[model samples]
Target: MDKKEISHSELKALIGKSPDLLLIDVRTKEEVDKGKIPGSIHMPVDSVDRDLALDPAAFQAKFGVQKPSLDAPELVFHCQMGRRGALAVEKAQALGFTKARNYAGGYKEWSEKAGK
Candidate 1:
């Protein structure tokens, strides 16, 4: 149950190397409309707790994506800033996502450093 804080550079490298990583964006729909990390799944922070409670198959169907197994290598979450990301990581881990991590440098920082 390690909730690590992933740095911007580390996240970028991860994106390049780990296709299995589950990148969850916890930003609002309005905020997300501006732009988001290329492959991130949109799961706003407010909905995380509820969504994590759904059965795996149901969750996957609802999200239109594969549900991360409990032992999935990495389940990273992020928002406009780091706060919601951290919370989402906690919620994911609580729901048994062993490799949950927060991308502390969220969309704002990502856009600033990684040019979106």
Candidate 2:
């Protein structure tokens, strides 16, 4: 199985059952001002490179979510569609977050299917 991406259904299941999962909404602030997946942390795609490098305490203060450790298994990124999310995942993986994954369907598919 490809480890670089996650399906919407898989993400939904994780939302229901995985306390450790981290859902990062990497769209622009304007796009996010409208809506995002429930419980996702809003971190725009531009800031991901800088923000993900912060120490845990600084990360929490800035993003209001605990920083995922280098190997956090359920770390996932999404955007309006999927392009930015893939880029975000690429940045994360490059920074040693090898377990980070893209939500390939993005919020379009999520909101349509999840009806939010």
- In model 2, where do residues sit more than 4 Å from their true spots? none
Query: Can you list the residue pairs that collide in candidate 2?
Result: none
Point to the candidate with the largest TM-score. Answer: 2
Writing each residue's lDDT as its tens digit, candidate 1 over 15-113 gives 858878789999999999999998898998999988877888998888877888887877889998899999998888888877888999899998997
Residue 81 local lDDT, model 1: 87
- CA-lDDT, candidates in order: 0.86, 0.92
Q: After superposition, how far is residue 84 of candidate 2 from its true place, in Å?
A: 0.2
